[model samples]
Target: MVRLSRFVRQTFLSFVAVSCVVASAPSHADGTAGWESVKEAGVLRCGAAVAPPYVMRDPKTGEYSGFFSELCRNFGQNVLKVKVEFVDTTWDNIVAGLQSNKWDLSMALNDTPEREKAISFSAPATDYNVSFVYNRNNPKIAKGAHSIAEIDKPGVTVAVMSGSAQDKAITAVFKQAQIMRLPGNDETRLALMSKRADLLADANTTNMLLTEAHPDWAVAIQPNPPLAQQEVAFGIRKDTPAADIAVLNKYVSEQVSSGAVNRLIKTSVQSMLASNK
Candidate 1:
């Protein structure tokens, strides 16, 4: 009976020790939150793309220099008082990187049902619209082609980037129109310049900036009205701490109200185009 009681006591002690270890395990939200991670690392890892005007990746330097990239840099360095590290990620992988905590934020993420489940977002830095563009001389379609229903007639050939929200939107709207899924925006633009496609629908902000720079190759607009005006915001992991998120949100809102964000966006867009030339 004495030996049995001693074994029972030892078993109880072992269980308690194991419980303490389990309770103290490092969690996904470890020592610091997302915001703190940026500060600790001395650089915010921002994911961006060469999606011209918004987040253009410089071909020559292999670095990011565009509206969204500048915006992230300015916000991190000035407002958040942290260093900014730009990570050039393709549009397809940006969301996954955010989920994996590989990238801290994205510059021009359009809020969608699929994305909402994956990441936390700041208040919209600006509104987003998908517009159709065509070559200036050919200008196959007018500016107001909002939906596939409006633009996708039998003969219309649409250029799309496969697996993009624009591509999904087009598929949802136009079943009859033939879609040419190009690899990227540059390819799509080439397709349009080469007269392979009558229309190219992409984020309106980007298309507008490109049109401003290269008036001959592309022009775009909302057909009747914008199909939807989505708020573009930075995407972080959805599990980010509330305190960190609050700080980021406050800074973004302040910048937006002060018009600093707008100015930054405009300047960056101009800078990107000028540098590209």
Candidate 2:
């Protein structure tokens, strides 16, 4: 009877201990299913479109470089303690890639309502200026237009990258102007350089870097500014658990506050200019 009682008590204690361990295990309430799968695989998949200043491809090594790529690496290496796998994607398919679970997140996208409907965005990591650029040889722009809107008219053609902030804004504000939607960011510059388009609409960093390389193009940035500033953020899937989004947002805020974005812009200008050479 004494042995029976001891065995019963031990069995009950063991069952309770196992139950407690199971109950205390982390779940979707605390962590993300996507992140959990990533952690298990030990690889963080990042979607990259390979746009300059934001995401540049190292021509020789087939490796990725630039501000957004570095930022993604920082998160994967430091925050998640995992290796990163950058998956090639295009801006037009960025949202679709995330929705299909092809990658965990997209890099340095300008957060917008259309994107928000397809996927979620982290808190504003940084903001960028979007402006117009024209070949210095274009006499109309050379006449010194004071306002971005001043250049918008029926005859003016603007070269824009498909599925970009500049593309959307130009379509919205300049109904009379012609928009030539190129396949990618590089093609917009080509269109302007070849005089196929009168103006090139892109982010300031891209315009600055290219202008430095060309010295033949001029930015049409107004002193008081023309367009509203756009927010840059990591693009995550909406189904990602809240904890993952919170982590990304916190890290982005810290990076922004630490002067990382500004530093990156300065460094990228130099590095990208060198790449152009």
Winner by lDDT: 2
User: What TM-score should be assigned to candidate 2?
Assistant: 0.83
lDDT of 2 by residue, 136-250 (tens): 6776564677565678777889898898777787777777778899878778888988898998888777777777787755555542454646677789877765555556666
Report lDDT (Cα) of residue 270, candidate 1: 76
Give the C-alpha lDDT of model 1. Answer: 0.69
Candidate 2 lDDT (Cα, 0 to 1): 0.73
Q: How many times do residue backbones clash in model 1?
A: 3
Output the lDDT of residue 260, model 1: 82
**Model 1: residues >4 Å from true position, as ranges?**
1-33, 136-147, 275-277
Clash-forming residue pairs, model 1: 144-222, 144-223, 145-223
For all predicted structures, in order, the TM-scores are 0.80, 0.83
* Candidates' C-alpha lDDT: 0.69, 0.73
The CA lDDT at 117 in model 1 is: 78
